[model samples]
Target: MLHTDAPGNTRQNGRWSSIVLIVKMLLTVAWRNLLRNRRRSVIVFISIVVGITAVMFNDGLSIGMISQMLENSIGSHVSHIQIHAKGFNDNRVIQNNMATPSEVENVLRDTPGIAHWSPRVVSFGLLSSALNSSGGVIVGVDPEREQDVTTIRRSIVEGSYLTGAPREVVIARRLADKLQVGLGDKVVGMASALSGDVGSDLFRVTGIFETVSSEFDKAYMFTSIDNARSMLELEDRVLEYAVIVRDINEVEDIAASLRSKLGDEYEVLTYIDLLPILVSQVDMYQSMMYVVYLIIALAMIFGIINTMLMSVFERIQEFGVLMAIGMRVRRIFLMVLLEAGMLGVLGTAVGLLLGSGLLLLFSHIGIDFSIFSEGLTSFGVGAVIYPRLTPDTILNVLIIIPLTTVLGAVYPAVRAMRLQPVAAIRYV
Candidate 1:
């Protein structure tokens, strides 16, 4: 009220002398009002809590999703780098003219950045059971060297992985079901070339693997390179050579380096290039998260604005009394702003604490998608997605909540400043 002495009041003489007490007094009144109407305060509390909860849920799922994508990127699909026949992509066929595998292996071995290397031949064929059949792609890999290339070893659910020669095969459970084949069963696999010569081979189903991915589970078979070459009649030739670097995340750089060195003689692919589906998904998820965050921030802003506006209306009589003595409208504005600021700061503190506790609890127990097992699988997500809370969420919530509250309250605080002393007195 800018140092105004009201009646016998002598606590004020100048703006700075009275500013501290006026702020303190406004806060005391606002807090008391907040407590006086517990129901409305509870509604505000719930609005903020729900808003934070939505943020936590979306953020946690996105984290888990990205983590799974990274794991899958490293585990099964593309190793850090891939070397393929130059025209292998355009024709989408493996050629017999492969570089001496030993020469390539030696180079990869001596390469400082390369940590793990594996040779593989990819082929496509229709797998047939007695009553059913399905077309799927197959990979011929060295079982002993496969572990270093893929976590397929860990995903083996039944029977040992096929090793040695070309008679055994490992298949995902989905393909096994389509062909009505199981461990130890003989499944006839047929492969054809761009030329007319074709061959059908019998493979004993040696192992069954189960991963949460329906796409993988549905259509891939694993065998030794010898089997793949024997069926295709291409000896001493490989379709592609896959490699893992010291750091999987550096795949794009590694691929670029390989491409720069090798030129067009070979095609180098990275995990990023291998699974473009995840790249698109990651982008979409990030965009959606930002949208949800903005909506929640706006909701919090409105709650604070409504409360501050009501406080300004209720205090009109008191403000008028101060103004009648000598208080300036600008001073009244600052006092209201200070009160709104206090509420914003306090509310943010409480909201953050509540949200942190809830996030911690969810992180420990984990938000299970098991209840939506069928739904998640239909969408290609695993049934168990652990909730992860990063420092980013906490920082965003803390910053956004208070900042939005103060921004929203500014309008009401401005309106209070425009009120004249006589008009405000008659406003009640």
Candidate 2:
């Protein structure tokens, strides 16, 4: 019994060793076949390279552009989160001012993640210089604290930021242009008061600021919170609290905690909530990119199919000879599949390296769209965009390209495996 078992085990080992050798030889042949038609293989290789490179470049650009827009919006005035009276964001009415300022202020001060907070008075009103008049949103802010929360102070291009002095106003450069006013010019602001009566005040254009957004430039005017309260007849009350967090990524968690503390009367909103359109642009770009990936993959699939079919057809006689010499039929199928996969992997590797290099280079140097600054400014994106590489984008490239090529080779592989040895050998 021991002797019989030993012989059977030996035979099994020999059979496995032969199978390994055959597979190794088939792999070598598959690779050689690709080299045999170098022109076709190189052409297919270039196509895959171009497709992958294009995908990476597009993804990087879109991510960079949207990210800059979000940062610009937040830094301009949105901040990380905002605490507003229940109806204030939607209605912008003085009647919707925070009902209990002390309570809300206490909650914010106690909040662990809040880095800085500033009270604001917001209203829609008209600013008229003697030469012209433009309607815009008026925001009242604490000069010192607002500087801690927003970048408007730094964005003052032509004049100084607000000093919290009596009746001081800061207008956008574009708005200043529209009103035919400049620094030290006088302007009158008019708005509806909490008492349902029209409120008006005269202000000096102490500063002019130019932010990334042309729309924001033309649509907002800022002044001291004291002056704004006096103008709108909402003394010692505020409509919103603009907040900045120590870590922006933790904004949602902090906002949730604030909501629970402050209750339902006040709305605790993150930048994601306050700037939905800008935030949604990231998701929209990602969704649209999948369509782009599919188009590129489909193009590669057809290219791979055409190339593999040609390789299979040109080697039909050689395949017949292999089968006649006792090579298994399935080896032919695997060989073709292997060839296609090798082509894909080689192309994808070169493409990924090239694409990642481009992304890395541009990430530091940045791409300047300054020539089209007007169009980008309208969308609230800056002129210079620094490309970013995400793990998910890299993962997509690793998974899609090789799989597409392998799937495309199925038909050619099947045809090669189905060849009849005798008939194939007898062919001319």
Candidate 3:
């Protein structure tokens, strides 16, 4: 019994050794086959590199563009969160203004995540200059607090931000151009007060600003809170309280906390809620990327299938010889698959290195599209975009490339496995 068990163990050990040897042999042969056809392999490799590089570059650009849009919109106007009187968003009437300014201020000041907060008196009115008139939103802000909450102060292209001087106003560059008004020019604004009286005021354009969003630049104007209160006939009432958080990503959490603490009298909204158009644009861009990736994958699939088919046909006699010398059909199939996988691995590695290097270089220098500045600004995107890459994108590429290669090699691998040794050898 002991002798018999010893013989069985020896046989099992030999079988394991043979499996390892077969795997090593298969890998070596696959490596050799890739090297044997230098030109063809290089052609396939280059195609894959080009495809991957294009994908990475386009993805990076899309991400950068979206990021810039969000940054501009948030920094320029939205802040991270906004607190408003219920129903104020739907109607711009003075009656819908925030009634408890002190309570809102207390909550903001007490909030741990709050970076800055500013109360604003917002109203819709017709702004008129000597040359032109347009309907726009007039926002009254606190100069010092507003500067902390937004980049409006920094965006001043000409003139200065509100100085609390009586009737001092800040207008956008586009509005200034259309109105044909320069710094110190007087502009008139007309609106209806909550008391059902026509309210009108004369404003001196003390500052001009340019922002990434053309719509915002053309449709908004600002003044000191004191001037707005006087013009709108309001007493210490604000339409909205805009709050900036330390981290933009934590805005929703902060908003939720504010909502619970402030009770139902005030409505708390994050930037995403305030800017639905921007949210929709981001979703649309992400959906479009899916289509783009699908197209790229299809292109890669076809190219790989063509290359693998050629490789299989070229190695027909060699495969037949192997089968004739006792190689199993499954091993033949596996070898073909291995070759395709090796190609994918090589191509993907080189592509990632090249693409990442290019992205890093461009991220610092940025890609300038100043020629399309007008169009880019219309979408609230900067003319110079700094490319970005996320870990999810890299993981997707790593998974997709190998899967694409395997799918492309399936038919060729099966064909190689199904070959009749005698017929294949004779035909070749």
Per TM-score, the best of the predicted structures is 3
The models' CA-based lDDT, in order, is 0.74, 0.90, 0.87
lDDT by residue (tens digit), candidate 1, 1-428? 75486655764458876777666776676567667667766676566666776677678767776666556655765676778877775566655335566656666666667878788878777888787999987788877877788877777899987676567998888899998888889888887742447766889898988766677678888888788778777677778788888876676777777777666777787766766777777788778877888988787777878977887787787788878988777767766666556556666677677666776777677667788866655445567776667887778877876677668778887888877888888876
Ranking by lDDT: 2, 3, 1
Candidate 1, RMSD to the unseen true structure: 4.5
Judged by lDDT against the true structure, how good is candidate 2?
0.90
What local lDDT score does residue 225 receive in model 2, on the 0 to 100 scale? 96
TM agreement with the true structure for every prediction? 0.83, 0.91, 0.94
TM-score of 3: 0.94
Task: Write down the RMSD of candidate 3 (Cα, Å).
Answer: 3.3
lDDT of 2 by residue, 1-428 (tens): 77876855674547889889877887899889999999999999999999999999998888888888888888888999999989777877889998578999999899898999999999998889999999988899999999999888999988899999988889988999999999999999999998999999999998999998888898888999999999888989999999999998899899999999999899888999999887788799989889988999999999999999999888888889999988888888989999999998998899999999999899899999999999999998878888888787788999999999999999999998998988777766
User: Candidates 2 and 3: which is better by lDDT?
Assistant: 2
Relative to the unseen true structure, what is the C-alpha lDDT of residue 374 in candidate 1, on a scale of 0 to 100? 64
Two-way TM-score contest, 1 vs 3, winner: 3
